[model samples]
Target: MADLIKRIQQGERITITNRDAPVADLVPSASGTEQQTLDAIAAIKNARAGTITHAEFVAMHAKGRR
Candidate 1:
């Protein structure tokens, strides 16, 4: 369960399955205060050297998992 939460925190969506069929999805919560959202955006902007498209972000994440 801890590992699953960690994966969700790392931006991976998890599907909960039952009988080999998808029953539910365990995804990160989108709910946050406005200040929190702004803080997160600011933090991200500060962390990166330049902008990246969503595809590039996904690719980078995949590469890091390897």
Candidate 2:
């Protein structure tokens, strides 16, 4: 069990089997928030360098739906 845990922490995917049938899987947790923050920051940088300012981007987006 300890070895299995160590494998998981080392970023190895593990399949737990019961009587030779797969029962469960262990994998790394995806970093959604970190990835999203990175993506948003990249987009903002690109917009500033490309065709839009931050204020123009906000103005182009919907303020509210009717």
Which candidate comes out best when scored by lDDT? 1
Error of 1 at 10 (Å): 0.9
Q: Candidate 1 — which pairs collide?
A: none
Cα lDDT computed for each candidate against the true fold: 0.73, 0.69
lDDT tens digits, residues 4-65, model 2? 87777556788889999999998755674467568668767877788677686775454322
Which regions of candidate 1 fall more than 4 Å away from where they truly are?
32-37, 43-66
lDDT of 1 by residue, 1-66 (tens): 999988887668999999999999988777633555686576468449567777766765675574
Model 2: CA > 4 A from native: 32-66
Residue 44, candidate 1: C-alpha displacement in angstroms? 7.8
- TM-score against native, each model: 0.52, 0.40
- Model 2 lDDT, residue 53, Cα: 74
TM-score winner: 1
